[model samples]
Each structure stands twice: as structure tokens, then as C-alpha cells.
Target chain A: MADRRPRKDAARNRAAVLAAADPLFARCAHPDDVTMADIAAAAGVGKGTLFRAFGDRTGLIRALYEARLEPVRARVEEGPPPLGPGSPPRRRVLALLDAVLCFKLDNRHLAVALEQTGDASPYRTDHYERWHALLKELLEQVPGGADADFTAHALLAATRADLVAHLADGAGLSREDMRSRLAEFAARTLGTED
Target chain B: MADRRPRKDAARNRAAVLAAADPLFARCAHPDDVTMADIAAAAGVGKGTLFRAFGDRTGLIRALYEARLEPVRARVEEGPPPLGPGSPPRRRVLALLDAVLCFKLDNRHLAVALEQTGDASPYRTDHYERWHALLKELLEQVPGGADADFTAHALLAATRADLVAHLADGAGLSREDMRSRLAEFAARTLGTED
Candidate 1:
């Protein structure tokens, strides 16, 4: 029991740092404005703890992004209709994209921060591969003669964080507007439009 | 005659620098590996001339990209049907995307470097706006009731430089395969497929 104390503390500290970092990233005018020191100060942990936990700013941002993405990931993994297993592939594809768009809309700052990390290719991430693989699998099951592999990439590209930011922030598209536009676009691409 | 000589020399130097830089960017394992010094040495010009002509690395890259894109731009602007002004909007759209895809495929390293510049949003570039606007205009002319604005963006997103690099370099797709797949994807999105 005594030996487990440090492990428990480490977990708590990580959660605390993530919790503290989330709102800081969300509220910042720019992602670069929120630094390690800010996160450590906000989390009530030492800067050493913050760096030790995440290695660097990019690492911290990645973890925070994943943490924030947990709910959506869980819903897709096991929750009910439109997102989880058992739904029609066509409907699931639309749902998945809509969910992704909404998630980006909701986490605009974080998404931009993660993408702006310079060294990370959005295409190279584990998160991207998981989404791409699932979307590609579903696309292959659709009845249309669309090339599933390329179509999957094209469809996912429509919801890229940078594109979403351009539409939402730069173009002033409301959430509902962006959602409907993406749905229509995806449906057309999928040949599933009614 | 003396005044004109300096202008001619500057023009010659600029052309030489672009000629030298083009092959270097295309051949380098990474864009960062091909620096201004290397370009100047290859062009047989002073590094000062390189900076004076293009400002810095990003400026130089932008100029080189524009210079390379010039022939493509000319073809679309006035050359002939399919990519130019008189073809059916549907066919023209397909041709336009194919041209963009091929250009990215040919200029993979340059495209990647330009995209990886970190601060420049691809969406914000004049080059992107021109392509998007032309694409949007063509989509509006197509028979489908698709949202021209969003559909144009979605279509263009498919041919983004990084996405192209991922397909060509990372995914090991050949140029022919990518072009056909993109053409098919665009056709499906436009509802112009047979």
C-alpha cells in the first residue's frame, strides 16, 4: 500500500495538469500564449512535475487533446446509434464526420494548437490512423462505387481542424451552418444523399 | 543602356536562382536540407542576392511555388477547354482538380515545405483563394444542387499538398493512381459520374 502512494500521486498530478491546461488552452488568444509555467501554476504542481509528466508543450497538448477527446472516442467505441457499432455504415459515416466536426468546433483552440505544433503531421498521428481506418472500413461497406480508400481520406479531409477553423472563425459559420454544410457535402461524396 | 543592364542582371539572377532552387527542392530528402546558402551556391549568385530577391526562405519558397504554378495557371486562365474557359463545368472541374493533383505530385518537396511553414494557413493564401473561387464557380454551374461553397472547399481539400504527400510518399500511391482516384472522387461529389 505504501509503495502505491507515489503511483496514485502521479496519476492525480497528471489529471490535475490536464484539467488545468484544458481551460487555459481553450481560453487563450493563441495556443502559444499558454505555457508550461502557466499550466504548472494553474494545476498547483511544480513546473518540473508538468514537464516530467508530459515531456514538453507538444506532448502536454497532445495528452490534453486526447483527454478531451475521450468522451467522443468512448461513444464511438461502445455507445449507441449513429456513432457506435451496429448502425448502417452510411449513417455511421455521416455521424462520425458530424461528430468530428462538432468536436473541432467545440475545441477550436485546442485543435488549432495541436495542429500548429509544426512537427506533427495530422496524417501521422495514431488518432488520425484510427479514425481513417474506421472511416475507410465503413466507406468500403457503402453501396456506392466510390473508391473507399481515397474517398475516406477525402471525406476526413473535409473536417480537418484547420479547415474547420477557417470556416468557423475566419468565415463566421455558425455551428449549425457548418454541420449542415458538412453533412450535405459528405452525403454527396458518399452517394447516400436523399 | 547602363540602367537597363542592372534590371536585366536582376532578372537573370532571379531566373537562375529559381532554376537552381527548383531541382534542389525536388531532389532534397527534406526541404530544410536545401538552404539559401545552398541555393546561392548552386545558382552561382551571392547569398545577399538570394535574400534581396526573395526576402527570406518563406518568401523564396512562395516565389518558387508561384513560378512553378505559372504554366498551370496560364493553361487554366486561357489555354483551352477541359481546364480553361469553354468546357462543360463538370468536365472542367474534373480537369482542374486533376491538374492541381498533378502539380502537387510533381512538386512534392516544395509543396510540403510551403505547407510546413507553420504560420501560413493554406486557406489564407491567395493561391488557395483563386483555386477555391474557380472551383466554387464551376460547382455552381454544375447541375447538382450541391452547396457550391462548401463543396468547392471539400473538393480542394482532397488535393491539399500534405494530403498528396501522404498518398504519394507515405502511402506509396503512384501519380496515376492518385489522379484517377481524385478524378473519381470529384466526379462522385459533383454527381457527374455515369
Candidate 2:
């Protein structure tokens, strides 16, 4: 048990280091500009420990991406109503958009960084597919039995980051306004008169 | 008058060169890979004439973009029906979307190239602002008057090539299906109950 405790502590430290580094990298103008020493200092771990934990810069970046997406994955899997299960499909779709919008706005830096790196992060593809599937399932539950796959694609396209950024930054639309409009759109597409 | 006819011929040839190269470059794997020589060959003009018409590679690219957008601009300015004058705002909005979708789907390569090139081109900013304005104007014309800017952002986001690619490639949604759902979503966001 004592030996197991040390291994667990090491794992916790590794996670903490990655978590701290993830946002920093995301917010940086260029991820390559960040140094391992800076990350170690921020994580409160020795530089040697940082290298030992992740092996190299590429490894660290991969770990950071995974750490960033874990909560997002869990939220979609089992968080609560709107984002989770139990809510109507229309509401769930709206909630998903809300969550995604908030996440993108709050973590714009990291999102931009991840996008710039061009790594095939599974989170993006997996989350998108999951959202589409969920939307499709919900659409099927509608009174008129709408086309789930088509509806899902439309909903997903309307919530993309580039489109959102164009709206928020380019068109000067407020976050609340965007959210409301999206919700209304979702409701209509799902065949809910209300 | 005879000299003026020569000038008119030059203008016609220039227009032809732009039209032919724009679609070809858009579909090509890399814009840089296609040279002035290639464009001239494709346009059935001498390389020297092509160079004289557009100063350099950058100039040629700009011309291509301008040529592609000209029809859209003309429609917005002087066309008729849903995308032009003498129609309800609701119908015009749908028409504008139909035009854009068709253009995008047909020139997907150009769309992808523009997006991948980032914000280096001055045309990007200008077009973005113009599209936003157009969307806002259409939205304001809605019977009850909704948030035009927000609706614009959501609608623009729904039409991005990345999202279209994702739906077509990742989710296997057909083009027809995506278009219908998007139209339905757009109608709802515009506040038409039907």
C-alpha cells in the first residue's frame, strides 16, 4: 500500500503539471515558443521531473490535449441535463451549443493553439461525432420523426468556432444573442412549434 | 473608335483569363503549384499577356477571387427575386443562401484555399463584413425583427466549408440533405413559424 501510494502521487503530479501547461500553451502565441523550464516552474515541479513525466515536447503536448478534453468528454457522457441526458433533444442540442460556445470563448487561446498545431486530436473528431449522434437520436424523438443525420449536420455546422468567431468578432454579436438565436433555430429544426 | 475596339478586346480577354483560372486554381491541390505559364496556357493566351494583365502571382489570385465574387455582388446589387430586388426579405434571404451554397459547393477548392491561407488577403475582411451587412439587412427585414447580427453569425457558421466537409466526409451526410436541413434551420432562426 505504501509503494502504491508513491505511484499514485506521481500520477497526480503528472496530471497537475499537464493541466497547468495545457492552458499556458493554448494561450501562447506559439506553442513552440514555450519552454519546458517555464512549464516546470509553473507546475511547481523540477525540470527533470517534467521531462521524466512526459519524455519530450511532443509527448507533453499530446498529454496536454488529452487532459484538456477529459472534462469535456465526461460532461458529454454524464454531466447533467441539457449537456447530459434527461432533457428533451431540442434542449439538449441547445445546451450542447451553450457549453461549446462558453468553452470556446473561455479557452479561445488554447483552442487556437490546438487548431494551429494541426494535430489530429481525437477529441475534436470524437466529440463532433458524438454530438451528431446525440442530435440525431434526439431528432428521432421529435413528434414528426425528422431526419436525424441531416438535422445533426446542420446543428453542428451552425456552432462551429470559425463561424462563432466571425459572429462574435467580425459581426459584433453578443454571446447571449448568439445563444438565443441558435436555440430558436434548433427548436424549429427539431419540429418543436414552441 | 478603332483604337477603342482594341482596348475592349483586351478587357474581354482579361475577363476570360480570370474566369478560367479562378475555378481551376480553386480545384487545384496548391495555388502556388499552378504558375502564370499554366494559367496562360489554360486561358489560351501568351504568358507575357497574362503577366501584363495581372502584375504577379498575388495579383492573379486577387483577380480570381474578385471574379468569383462578382456574380454574387451583382445579384445583391441588381438581381431579382429572392436574392435580389422585388421580393420579401424572407425569400431574398433564402435565395442568398441558395446562391452562396451553390457557389461554395461548386468552388469548394477555392473556399478551402482561402480559409487555409489565414487572413493575409485583404479581400477576406472585406467580404466578411459585406456578408455580415447583407445578413443583417435581411434579418432586420424579418416581420417581427430579430437580432440580425446574431442570426448572421449563426447562419455564416452554418455555411463554412469546414463544417460542410465534416458533414460530408465524417458524418456521411449527403449534400442535398445538408442543404435542406440548413434551409430549415435558417428559416426558423429568421422567425418564420413554418
Candidate 3:
């Protein structure tokens, strides 16, 4: 009973920390401004608890990002037509990219913070590999005879967090406009444009 | 003659620094490891002169990149068909993307170094604006009626330095293979595949 209690408490604390960190990241003027101390304070936990739950600031940011992305991941994994397993390859491809673009648009700050965390290439992450693999698999099922591997990378690059932020913030592209543009680009790549 | 001598010396020092820095960046294990002191030492100039000439590490790297890119810029500006102004719009788009991919591939470390500097989004650079503007203008002239502005950004994103580095270094994509993939992707985007 005692051992189980600590495990439950750990899980609850993790949830609290992620929930508290999300809005802090979203509202900060710069990602660097949102520190572990700030997140710990907001979560009403000690700084040691924050460090224990997530190893560092980057770790906490990544956890918060993943938590926010969970719903989108679920939709793509097992939801309805156009995003899940039930749709045509071309439609799924467009939907997947649009989902990525929309997600980045919605979580612009967190996404940028995660990508900009360190010297490591963003492409090295398991998250990137998963997306690239899924996209490549879908592109192979499409009719274009494109190089699915490179095509997947090119398609995802179009929705890179920094690029999305640039379009959204610097160029002032509306969410609908960015999504439409990505859909058009993906359709042309798949040779399925109407 | 006395005033001209100092100007001539500065110009000579600038060229020497770039020449010395080129191989250093190419051979470094990591970009941050090659400091301004290393560059000044290689060029036989004082560190103060290096800083005075280029402002900082980012500025020096940018200048060196611009120097190396001169041949490409000149070719695209006025040299010949395909890369130059005389080629058909679709062909020029293909050529322009190819040039960017090849340039990134050839100068992988230096390009990555310049892009990785500090907190700046690479989209804000004047260098990027020039390429995007040129590509957008060319895409507008193409017959497919694609959204030239967004399409230009998407196409250029495919050849981003870190993406090129990831493909070249991490994925082990050969130079020729990378070039071919970019060409194919650009052709499909421009709707000019034969």
C-alpha cells in the first residue's frame, strides 16, 4: 500500500507539472524566460520535485509538448476518415500535414522551445522519425511514384515549427491560409490535385 | 596612398580570414568549437581585427558563407541558361532549388553553423529573403498557378541547412542522391516533370 501510494503521487505530480507548465510556456515572451523554478512555483511543488519529475527545463518542456500533442496523436492513430486508417492515401496525406501545420500553429511557442533547446538536430528526435516514417508509408501508398522518403521529409519541412512561427508571426499568414497552402503543396506532390 | 593602404590592408585581411576559416569549418567536429580566436590565429591577424572586421562569430560566418556563395549568385544572376535569367521559368525553379541543395551539401558545416547561431529564426535573414523573393517571382511565372509565395517558402524549406545536414550526415544520403531527390521534388512542385 505504501509503495503504491508514492507511485500514484508521482503520476499526479507529473500531471500537475505538465498542466502548470503549458500556459507558462505559451504566454512567455521568450521560451528561455520560462524556467524550472517558475514552473515549480506554478505547480505548487518544490524545485527538486520538478527536477525529479523531469530532468531539466528541456525535459519539462518536452513533456508538456507531448502532453498537448496527445490528442492529435490519438486522432491520427485511430480516429475517423482523412486522418486515420480509413481514408484514401492522398486525403490522409493532406490531413496529416494539415494536422501538423495546425498543431504547430496552436502550440507555436512550445514547439519552438522544444526544437530550439540544444545543439542536437531536431531531426534526431524519435518524434521526428515517427512522423517521417508514417508520412513515408502513406506517400508510398499514393500514386505519384514519388520518392516517398525524400517526399516525406520535404512535406514535413513545410510544417517545421520555426517555419510555421515565421509564417504566423512574421508574415501574418492566417491559420486557414497556412493549412490551405500546405494542403495544396501536399496534393501537388502526391499528384492528386483537383 | 596612406589612406588607401589601410583600406587595402583591411580588404586583404578579410579575404585571408575567409580563406583560412573555410577549411576549419568544413573539418570541425562541431561548429561552436571553431572560435574567432582560432580563425584570427589561422589568418595571422589579431582577435581584435577579426571582431572589428565582422562584428562577431555569426557575422564572420555569414561573411564567409556569402563569399563562398558568390559564384552561385553570379551564375544565377547573369551567367547562362537554367540557372541564369534566360531559362524557362519552370527550368529555372528546378535549377534554383538544385543550386541551394548543392550549396548546402557542399558547405554543410558552415551553413549549419550560421543557422544555429543564437535565438534568431533563420527566416528573418536578408539572405533567405533574397532567395525566397527570387524563387517566388520565378514560381509566379510558371504555368501551374500554384500559390507562388507559399510554394516558394515550401520549396526552399526542403533545402534548409539542418535538413540537408540531417540527410547527408545522419541519413547517409549521397550528394548526387540528395541533388536528384531535390530536383524531383522541385519538378513535381512546379508541375514540370517530363
Candidate 4:
């Protein structure tokens, strides 16, 4: 298809492209194995469409990551107590971390691919800055939140996709156990542990 | 120049290669610039010797990382107070983390090369395992030590090479500030804060 299109059709094509890329990333043993050509063929779109849609492979992986993250991000942003703004600071911190951990666990392969590609540091991304800011802000609200910035980074570091994958795949740690341990670890940092 | 050299000369040549490669990696804008041939020429040896000793670029990097880490590893295992075996658990934990962070700061370029190459997960390395085990042991001695294992991993994750580079290169955080921040973060996790 040409770059020009009806808005609705453009949106539909973008959705199709993302949807097509998801499982292809999930099933591939390596991220580089899934190319724009593969995504285009799977989505029944031309290679030009995939490029025009996502700019390139990194952009596509990033879009898919952001799309998959939308639901959880929304919940953390506006859902309810615990994850949303309404919860007490400590509880909110834990909830935000749990949400990040869960997201990584649920999308391990995609997360790994997106992280390991583009010769870019995952720390340099906008979403990373956003999450770090949110966590740092929430930590600031806690009583002993003096080192909120560093503490936030430390907490997020624990949930890094590669770490999660190592724990899950190499260490044989169950997801539930991983979550529980992370929650407990965060609690220690927040000074809220029993 | 050949692999069949007497063991003493081989030892001398191996040390010479690591010595020559150190400044090259430290000075280069990119790690790839410090090639095996470069090390060979700098070490006054043949390229065949460099390959015979270290296998390839990734192998050379890994060897350098381990070689550089030997002193700090020794201090943690049996040296004096703080990082040594005799410090209090909380203090020892802080010391170990500081040591790791300082090492990364001191070896930024080489560390990045070792991590970026090989496509290996850093978590699976024997040294990482050793560090985790050591941290877990120290955390186990802290008052609320129930989650020592997870806490050890979380704490170490904060010092990951890429994150260290991000803080140093992009964020432009001063080394002292980074050290202070990490110390404070570890203090929080160790439950030693006021």
C-alpha cells in the first residue's frame, strides 16, 4: 500500500502489523530471527508498509512493547487503589513494582528482544525515564524516602528482563515465587516490612 | 611467537598481552578497535599467540575482566575490615557493592565491551554466581535476612555494567555521587537507615 490512506485503514494496518509481530517475536529463539519482511508477510502487508508503519525493527519492537504495556500502565496511572494514585505511597510503590515485574514476566521474549537490540541502552528510553520518575516520586512520598532516586533505580533493576529470564529459565524460579520475592525485597527498601 | 613456547615464556607472554590490551581498551572510543592483532602487536608477540591464548575477542575481554577483578575479589574474601571477611554483615554488604561499583567506574569501557560482546547473559557467569553467593551470605546475617538470596540479586542488579554506564556517560553523575547514592540504596535495603 502507498503511504497515503484513509485514517481508519491506516490505524487498522498499524494494528495488524503489531499483532503480526507479537507471536513471531514470542516464538523466535532469537529476536534477530524475526525481520520486518517476516512481520510484513505475516500481517499480509507489504515490506514498505511495515517500514512506513514502524520506521524499522527497533521501532516495531518498541511499539509492540508500548502497546503490550498500555493496559498495565493505564492501571498504574488511573485504575484504583494499590496501583493507582489513590493508594498510600508505600502500597503504591509495591504495586508499581509488581506491575513492572509482571509485565516483564508475561512478555519475557519481547522484552529481551527489545532490550538486546539497536545497540541502545534500555536505560535511555522514554518509558524507562517515566517509570523511574514515577517510582522516584512515589518513594519520595514515603517517610524515609530521602534516597528516592537511587532507591527507585535499585528497585527497577531487580525486575530487569534479563534478570527475570535468568531467574525463570536458569534458576527455575516460578513466577509466583519471583513476584513474592520482589515484593518482599521492595518492602525492605520501603521500610514497610513486618 | 608460537603456542609451543616453554611454560615460563608463555606465562610472561600471557601477562604481557593482558598488560598491553588494558591501556588499549581503556583508551579506545570503541572496544572493537582493540583487536587481537592490536594486542599482539602491542605485546611484541604474533597474532597467533593472542588467539592461541585467549581464543578470540570475547574471550580476551572476559579474561581481562576476570584478571582485573582478582584483587577486589581477594579483598572481599580475606582482606581487612569493610570489604573483608571480618566486617559486620551490613557493613560488608555495603563494602562489597561499593567495590563492584568502583570497579565498573574504573573499567567502564572494557566492562561495556565484555558485556556487549559474546551475547551471553551476565547472570550465568561463575563470577556472578560467586558474588551472588557471597552477597546472599552477608545478607543472611542481617536482621531481617529471610529474603537474602533475592536481595543479593537485586542489589547486584543495580550495579549492572549498562546501568553503570548510563549513570556515568549519559546522566553525567559524578563518581562520588554515584557511590554515595549506591551506598544509601544499599543502606536502605540492609535496614540500617534511621
Go through the candidates in order and give each one's C-alpha lDDT: 0.87, 0.67, 0.87, 0.86
Where model 1 places Cα greater than 4 Å from the true spot, the runs are A1-13, A28-49, B1-13, B29-50
lDDT of 4 by residue, A71-131 (tens): 9988888898889888889988888999999999999988888777635778888789999
Per-residue CA lDDT of model 2 for A1-194, tens digit only, reads 46545487688879889778876766664455678898998888998888888887656765665566679768877988878888886677778767776666555555444443333322245555676677678777777644667666666666655556555665576888777777766665555466
Per-model DockQ: 0.59, 0.22, 0.62, 0.58
Q: Where in model 4 is the C-alpha error above 4 Å?
A: A1-17, A33-52, B1-24, B27-51
Best-matching candidate per DockQ: 3
After superposing candidate 3, which stretches have Cα over 4 Å from the reference? A1-17, A33-49, B1-16, B36-48
Model 4, first chain, TM-score of 0.92
Every model's Cα RMSD, please? 3.5, 6.8, 3.3, 3.8
User: Pick by TM-score: which candidate is best?
Assistant: 3
Compared with the true structure, model 2 gives a TM-score of: 0.71
Model 3 vs. true fold: TM: 0.89
Ranking by DockQ: 3, 1, 4, 2
> Candidate 4 has what TM-score?
0.86
TM-score for each of the candidates: 0.88, 0.71, 0.89, 0.86
Comparison by lDDT, 2 against 4, better one: 4
Model 3 per-residue lDDT tens digits across residues A1-194: 45444577788888899888888988985688887889889999999998998888777877888888889989999999889888988878888998988999999999999887755788988778888999999989987558999999999999989889999999999999998888888788877456
* Candidate 3 per-residue lDDT over residues B1-194, each given as its tens digit: 46544588898998899999999989986788788899999999999999998998888988988888889989999989889999988889889899988998889888888877755888888779989999999999988658999999999999989899999999999999999998888888777457
